[model samples]
Structure formats: structure tokens, C-alpha cells
Target chain A: MKKLINKPENFVDEMIEGIILAHPDMVRTPGEDKRIMVRADAPRKDRVGIVTGGGSGHLPLFKGYVGAGLCSAVAIGNVFSSPSSDQIFQATKAVDGGAGVLYLYGNYGGDVFNFDLAADLAELEDIETLTVLGRDDVASQPKERSADRRGVAGIIFAYKAAGAAAERGDSLKEVAAAAEDIIENTATMGIGLSPTILPTTGKASFDLPDGEMEIGIGIHGEPGIHRGALETADEVAERLMRPLVEDLGLSSGDRIAVLVNGMGATPLEELYVLYRKVHRIAEELGLTVEKRYVGEYATSLEMAGASLSLLKLDDERLALLNAPASSPFFREG
Target chain B: MKKLINKPENFVDEMIEGIILAHPDMVRTPGEDKRIMVRADAPRKDRVGIVTGGGSGHLPLFKGYVGAGLCSAVAIGNVFSSPSSDQIFQATKAVDGGAGVLYLYGNYGGDVFNFDLAADLAELEDIETLTVLGRDDVASQPKERSADRRGVAGIIFAYKAAGAAAERGDSLKEVAAAAEDIIENTATMGIGLSPTILPTTGKASFDLPDGEMEIGIGIHGEPGIHRGALETADEVAERLMRPLVEDLGLSSGDRIAVLVNGMGATPLEELYVLYRKVHRIAEELGLTVEKRYVGEYATSLEMAGASLSLLKLDDERLALLNAPASSPFFREG
Candidate 1:
């Protein structure tokens, strides 16, 4: 594929430079080796700072959420790769603000290890820190071990709850707990119809048959649990939602918020068809859909497929869901 | 330009069906004359109902914004064609819950005419209505007549502000006023690196040499104001932003929100490159970016280009921007 880029090796550096240039309203503090992205209007001291880090490729995922009422800073790594401990530490210190900082990220092995090391480094600088990992992909595990599932689009919901908590002066620990609560309540499962083309490779990370799809796929081009011929829109929605509903054990009279998110390449029309089926199924199950979203919330480059996420809502989760947030990807009061 | 669609005529209907099937949490009234998308839990009488309508191919433009705290109904027409007046009228009546309804859409001749006609039809049924048209594409018209410019990605910001206003229980007139204010304050310009494939023609809507771009193109394959060899990201950003900055007549010390939106095919990396240049120039011009978004907010199929939008903001626009909105395409609260 033809792309407008210089050297693939310098892609990330150039990307970071461009981010800083375009958002001078945002601050890019170069640390020892890494950079931290922060809102230009850094608030006064005494407010807990929100920090998130992750691999690149998911634009507006880690960095897009940086601003008031959202993440205070973002530490970005290479595509599908975790940022280094030093990078995380630099971002933590840069946005600490003296109150504390909460490091929120997806539950991936590399991320956990690096974030733990970064926490140790931050503590040496007298900066307190807390961490919360999103583990919301129900399809990654059987129903008996759903908590061990990988994190995906459901992390956006966690970001909002955590950002709202941080914006309201919650301590780092409290904010971390709140984010974890949201993550635990949320569950996601994705299907990939087409593979994403890695920027460096310029080749698809993986491939499936032209008229087939892989269910329970990972964002980094990992194989899904099941591969089948292309199904009708209703069948696709059912296949993706079955695990979430079964895992969440959503029963009659339960209230939930549903997100039918396109992986990347699926059109909005197809998403709505999926939504129609999912809504009917939810009603048949006696659940009330308090809120709904259908579109590309989290994507894997130009991959085709969709993910279904459900957050079992209670008063607290609902309140946080209703809290205001502003990010490049998602904006609200 | 290969797409996975089965038949040309079934593309829109099939896609809409897929969305509803996947997002059972959302509602799409099937067998209707027009495709009407609505939140599943709609009919909330307390909040002012927000609605938008437009042509298809621009995924998430008219359809993706249907959800809580955003547009309650989005009437989608055929690819690059306006929804009929009756179709838009039915959507308005379906979502109207007595508080009132605000018809917000892009500034295109067909859309304006149809949506206005829909408003007239709705009023005859005792449903209060108001209209706000987005006219943000500064490059579509000469500086002397910038208000006549076509709308593009900037309409997303208008949807956001109007959604927030409705969510806050602003009366129909109040929401309409807020949306109009956003339209007046916003300016946008786009450059096309590649043309989108029109499903009917099964070919690119327009063509450019491998190393060229067309600036100031509309979402529906409209001819651009200027075309030239492809330039560096910096040059492209300047070309798109200079007109917007000049047309808006922004003075030093102005605060604005920025949107760096892709026309489908451009990668986030390039968008960031453009954003960097746009941000630097804006900073040099003494503008403060209160918010920034970088992604495919309003796309034209798989076109390769980007648009830069600046919404000059005061306290009111800023507050409305910060308000909670929950749409499929954009949501935080």
C-alpha cells in the first residue's frame, strides 16, 4: 500500500513531533528519553492527575483522551507495543501536580510489567501513584474465567469513569478503584472480517478468506477463537454478543448500556443492522438498554469486523457514565 | 477499490440492517420509506430531542450521531443524496417527545431544502421545530463570500454543541440558537489526496495524479477549488488552514477548538502531521486551542484527504462544548 510517510523507522518520532506541533495548546514535555502529552492549561496543584499509556495505532486511544476532565497526560509506545518504564515515569512526573497520579491502561503483560517499574521510579521522586488495568474482553476467556479476558474498546468507558473521578478531586487510589470498577462491570468481544495493514510492514498483519470472519480476534492481528464463513448481519451480532451476554450472566430485568463498535472497516449501515438485532435480543432477554452506541469506538487500522461491549450499570456506574468528559475521540461535558 | 458489498442497490439497506442487528441497543424502524435511526431508549420527554439528516457515504455523519445526549434521530439518504422531505419528516416525528426538535445538518443545497421541508411538515403536526445549517468549509467559497462555503467535518462540532444543549434541556429555540452560533463561529477547509469510490459508478468519484491533491473538495465528490502536486504535510496544512483563518478573520489572542478530520483513507499519522503544522501556525497567530480532535469524523467513503476546522469560541460556546453528549460517533459523559 502506498502511504505518505518518510522512513518507517522514524514514523513514531515524526508522529510525536507532529502531535506537539499541532497541539501547542497541549504541552509536550521531553523527558530523559520519552515524551509526555498534557493539556496546555495545566490545572493548579492539589488535583489528582490522570495518566494513560499504551501502544500507538489506536489514535485517540491513549493520547486522544488527554485534556481536562479526561486524562492529564499520555505516554505512547510503538504500535501494539508497551511504552518503556522510563516513558511512563516521565509522563507521571510531568503531570503529577503534587496531588497524585493514576496510571490507567489495558491489561497486557508488557504494559503491567512496565507500569509497575514506572511506579517504583515515580515513588522515588515523592510522587504517589496508583494503577488500574482494563480487562474487559470476555471472548478471550471461557465464561468460568471471564475476568482474565483481554481489554479492548470497553476501555473507553473506563477512561470516562476514571477521568470524571480524577477531575472531581478523587485521590489516586479512589480513582483507580473507580476505574477498576468500571472495567470489571464492562465486557467486550470482537470479530475481524479483514486484517489490519501494519505501517512498518505495509502488509496485512493476518488474513482470512474473502467471505469469512474470525470471531474473538485480538486488536494486534491475533487469531480469533472461531473462524467461519461470512454470516448474515444478525448472525454476526449474535455470535459477538452471545459470549458477552452469557459471561455477564445478564438476566431478565437487568439494565445495561450497549456499545456495538466497528473494528475499523465495517460501514455504519452494517453496524446499525447489527444494532437492530442486538436490541431485539436484549429485549427478549428482558434487559433494558439504558444507552447505546454504534460506530468505530476502538479500531484496528482498517480491519473489518465489529465488537460488542456491554456495561452492567448500577447507580454509581451510571453516574460516572453520565459524567462529562472531553477527548479527541470522544467529547462531552 | 474493491469493496465487499454484494449488490449496489442493497448496499445502503444491507448496511443499515447490519447496524441494527449488531447494536440491538439502538433502534432502526425498518420497512419505512426512509432509513430512520434512533436510540433504543428514545422517547425521553424531558430532554429536547436533537435530530440531524444528510446523505450517505459519509459514515457516522447522519447515522452515527444517534444516541443519548446527542442526536436522537438521524435520517440517512442514499449515497451523496439528500433524504426526501417525507423521510426526514418521519424521523423528526418519531424522535420528537413534545419538548421540541432541532433539525441540524450540513450546508448543502439539497440537504437544506429537504430538511427545511421536513421542518415544515413536522410543524403541521404540532411538533415545534428549529433548524441550524453548518456552513464551515471556508475553501468552498471566496473570502468575500465565505458564508456560502459548503459544510464538512465541522458539522460534527455543530452536532456536539447542539446535542449538549438538548441534553441540558435547552428549549428547541435555545438548542437551535446554540447550533447556529457554532455554525457561525466554525470554519473548515479540506484537501483531497485521493477520491472516494462511488458505489453506483464503481469507480473513484474523481481522479488525481499519484503525487497531487485537490484542496477544498466537498464530501460528495464535488470539485475542489484548487488542485496541485502533493506537497509536504506542512504545506497541505497551511493551504487548508490559511483560508479558514483568513475567512474567520481571527484576531490574535483568540481561543478556538480544532478538528483535524480525515476524509476516510488518510492515516492518523498524516493527520497528526497536518495537525502539527496547523497547530504551529495557529499558535503563531496567537490562537489558543481549547480542544482538538483528529480522526475520520465525517468521511466520504474511502477518500484520502483531510480537513481542518477551527471553531472560534467564547464562554458560551466553550461551555456548551463541555456539556455532556452521548452519540455513537462521539460521547464522553
Candidate 2:
């Protein structure tokens, strides 16, 4: 394998150690257990805390969002595996201000069970906790069953809006409501030209023929809606954008935030190529693109593909996105 | 070919169009020719204007630096090709405030020829222009021939320091001097596990066996110092860090800036794993890492490898790096 790693078993810890060593000003291990990282100035009294957690491999996703204006802490796991309930509880304890804590994370069975258990543990200590799942991947389920849809790159919307609410001293209930509102309005779909390779197994996450592509694939290599010959950038953009606008019931006068995310190995040049078509389509549909992000926000190891996410926005969501924030991998103003 | 592009010929223009549409607030085409992009508020009165340009593949390298407190403008070219002299001259004119303009770019033959020609054109139009080429790739030449080394990711140090000098209304000579100083202090080396595929050629950039790596590889697949079986992350980090530390004549009392840049397909997780070892090495040597940047600063489309750069830092260099700057792809505060 051509992976630039040491012993596969030490992959996650080594990465976390590097993060702590590189960005001590922004993030730190909350306690002796290095798996839980909280913002350096976490536990702000009278402020609602936001805690997120998921598997490893998705940099700038579960852990990269932990900062002053984003998630207060994160519980990390091994590649493509959920964090343990104890670790999640530890994250909750680390970031708990007197106001309470909110659990925000992707909607996967393993993560859901783990975060739910962590909430129960927090309640034993008299710390109020609320859970809001990021469910925005439209291809995972029909609109009628939207709650079952998996969360992809669109969770960043929830993180931004909810984090802003928490940062401004909002109550835990208000923060959870804000997160849920953004999750309800966001939609995302991904196309994979290649599969990611797992370091531990030293194997491909999924297999496909040399020139084929998979549409609507999940971040963990879960099966998608279609598997066929590769399509052009314009064609793929259209395929992903149409369903997102439809799922959000977007109209001509709608204002939206768009994210054209590269999976892993796809070039930034190609992401812009995809974003160009998405822009043209948004204009053609009479939708106004207020804010756009084109980069590698969420990735699946070195998988070569791209995902498109649209968040139907109003004044509140737009203001939240504009708020100044800083983290190791992201910054906003 | 699995590239998500409509036509190979349309790649550069399409990417530019996407950038313009996505970031209209921060950048704009200064004239009818969309090949040239300048910061939205260019031509700041009495401030030294900075312009940079190079081939198209390296995003954020040549163009992504144009913004407030960064490069004022950029002239773009096709993939792995230099911008025309006319385009560079146009960029120089667009950002030339009452003070003067500084041409900062990588050291490549095509770029040197074009930027020099552009300087002549700018002089004819009464626009004062100074040139500072980035030549920091240590493996391309020995210490006795350091002036001829190929420029790689280390050019970003020049861009940051020089851009800051210009932003504070320094004269053209001062800006060029800052860039030159940073270029002199910086050293970079890269490793390649595989080759990048050019969109136009539908072929690999260089040939390498499956499990072998090329150490000290140039950004454009130029010959490197060694080729052998892929080494572990720690070993690779040691191989790269030792030379950079020695080339700078670093000692126990020195402060340095560390950049671990991914050359496109490598995962961020792997980059951190590499950084862990690099940080440990710095500690062992008593060198202080006062500033650190880890991401895809410079890239060759989808090459699966990485580069490490070290800049021996003084108070002035560290302050310039700490200055607030913003561009489409980068932000510092």
C-alpha cells in the first residue's frame, strides 16, 4: 500500500497527537484520554456547549469543527467506526458550561446509539443534554422518510448555525432548535469516481471497475442510488443539484448557501469545474446563491469524487454564517 | 480517463469562471480579459501593488493569494504553462497604485521569460515593476548553486511576507526585498508516491513503480535526489526534516515556521501523522516551531505525495506571518 502511515493501529492516536501539537492555541485534549478534544477555552460559564463526535478519517468534519464558535468539543473514533459512549460522555463533561450541552453529529446507527448513551450518562450528573442528528443526504432515503437519510457534508450548516447560537449565550433548547432547523433545510448528494482505502485493513473501502462511477455514495462507502459509467462535470452537477433544490422546495426567490466539496483525491481545479456548472444551474433556476464554499470540507480518505450541498437560507442562517469564527482548518467572517 | 471535465481545453477557463462566480465579493476581472484577476479593491492609493502568476494547476499558489493583505492580482495560464506577457502586463497595470508594482512568482523558465517580457511592457507604459523569483527547492541544486534551484511550495513564504510589506504602503523596493529575504531563508523538499495525470494529455506526469517513492521530487515531476521503496511516515518525515533543518543552518536558539503541504491526493490525516514526527524532531533539536501551517498550499493536480518547508523565522518574519490576510483559499490572523 502507498499510505504514508506507520503501524495501522496507531493511525488515529498519532493523528490526534499531531493535531494537539500543531494547534495548541485552538484545541487541546480535555483530559488524560487524548481521544476527546475540546476548544482550549472551553467550558465558558453561562454558555450552552456544543459537542460533536464521529469516526476518524473525515478531517474538518467531526474534530475540525471544534472551536470557539463551532463545536466546543469532539469525541474521536477509529477510521469509519463510532466513538465509544464513555468517550462521548467525556467530551460532554469537558465542554459543559452551567447552561447545558447539545449533542450534534451525523445520523448513523452506531453514532446515534453512542451519543444517546452519552446523553443518558450526562443526565446522571445533572447535566441537561439534547440530541440533534444531521440528516441531509437526500439519496439515502425518500423525502417521506427524510429522518432516515444519512448526513454528509451538509452537517457543516448545522454546525455553523447552531454554534453561532451557542456562542451568543443561547439556551440549550434554542441551540437544539437552531440545529434542527438547519438540518431540516439542508440537502446533499455525492458522486464517487474511486473508493477510499482503509489504513487498518490496507484495503479499498469499496470496489468498482476502473472507469465506472457511483452516484449518491455515503462517506463510509455505503451503496448509493446509481452505479454506472462516469459522467461529465456538468452532468454530475445537474444530477446532484436538481434533487437538492427539489428536496428543499426551493423556489425562484430563494436564497441559498452552496458547498461544492471534494471527497479526497479530486483536484480543487475539478471542484471549481463542478461549482461552475452548479452556479449556472442555480441561476437558471432563478435561485440566488448568497454564500458558496468550494473546497475539501468533508472527505473519505483518498476517495476521488465530489459532493454538492445546498442549504435553503433565510436572514438568520445567513447572519450566522457570516459571524467571525476561527479554527485550525476553517475560518469565517 | 475519469476526470470530471467536459473538454480538456475548457478546463482553465471553466475553473476561472467558477472562481469569479463563487467569490465575486473578494475578486474580479480587472478588464475584458477574464484571464487576469485582481483583488476586489485593487489600486489602493500609494500602496505597493503585488502581482503574481504561474501555470494553472497550482491553485492558491499563484492566484489564490490575491486578496486583502496578500497579492493584489494574478495572471493565469493553462495547466503547467506560463501566462502570456500581455496578461502579466495587464495585471501589473491593474494593481499599480501611485507607488509601484512587485512581480512575485515561482522560479520556472517559462514564467521567468514571460514576467521579464511583461516588465519591459510595464516600463514602456510608465509602470515601475520589480521582480523577485522564489527559488527555495533545495533538492534542485546544491548550496553553491542555490540561485538556480526550482521554486516549490516555499514560495508561499515570500508571498506572505512581501504581500504584508506592500499592504502597509512600503515602497516597491522594500516589498521585493522582503520577498527576497524570505526566499533566501526558506528551504523545501518533496516526496512523490505516484504521478499526477494531466487533463490535456490524459497521461501520468512521471512513471514510478507501485511501492516506490521519489524523494526530493519537484512539483512538476522533475528529477529528484533519490527513489526507493516507500518508507514509513516517521522515516519519510525524518528524511525530509533533517535536510531542511541543516540547509537553514538552524541551531538550538532558532525559531522556525513549519509547513507540511499536501501535493493533492494525500489525506490530511497522513499529513498530521507526518507533522507529529516533524514536531518531535524540532523539539529534539531545540528548535522552536513558533508558527505552523499544514494543508494543501501548493499542489500538482492529483499527485499522491507531500512536501515539507521550513522558514527560519526572526521577529519580523513571524510578525508578517501573523498579520491578518484573507483570500479565497487562505486566511491568517
- For all candidates in order, the CA lDDT equals 0.77, 0.92
User: Against the true structure, what is each candidate's TM-score?
Assistant: 0.75, 0.99
Residue-by-residue lDDT tens digits, candidate 1, B1-333: 334354567778777765665555555563355388877777678677877878888876777788766788888888888888988888887788899888888878998899888888888999888877778877677766866778788988788888888877888888888888888888888887767777667787877776677888877767888887776666677788887787778989999899988777666776776677778888899998888877778888767777889999999888877877665456543
Error of 1 at B184 (Å): 8.3
Fnat of all models, as shown: 0.30, 0.72
lDDT of 2 at A261: 94
Candidate 2 Cα misplacement greater than 4 A, ranges: none
Q: Who wins the TM-score comparison? A: 2
lDDT of 1 by residue, A224-287 (tens): 7889787666777778777788777789999998888766656555566677778888989998
lDDT of 2 by residue, B45-127 (tens): 89999989899988767778899888999998999999999999999999988788999988899999999999999999899
DockQ of each: 0.25, 0.82
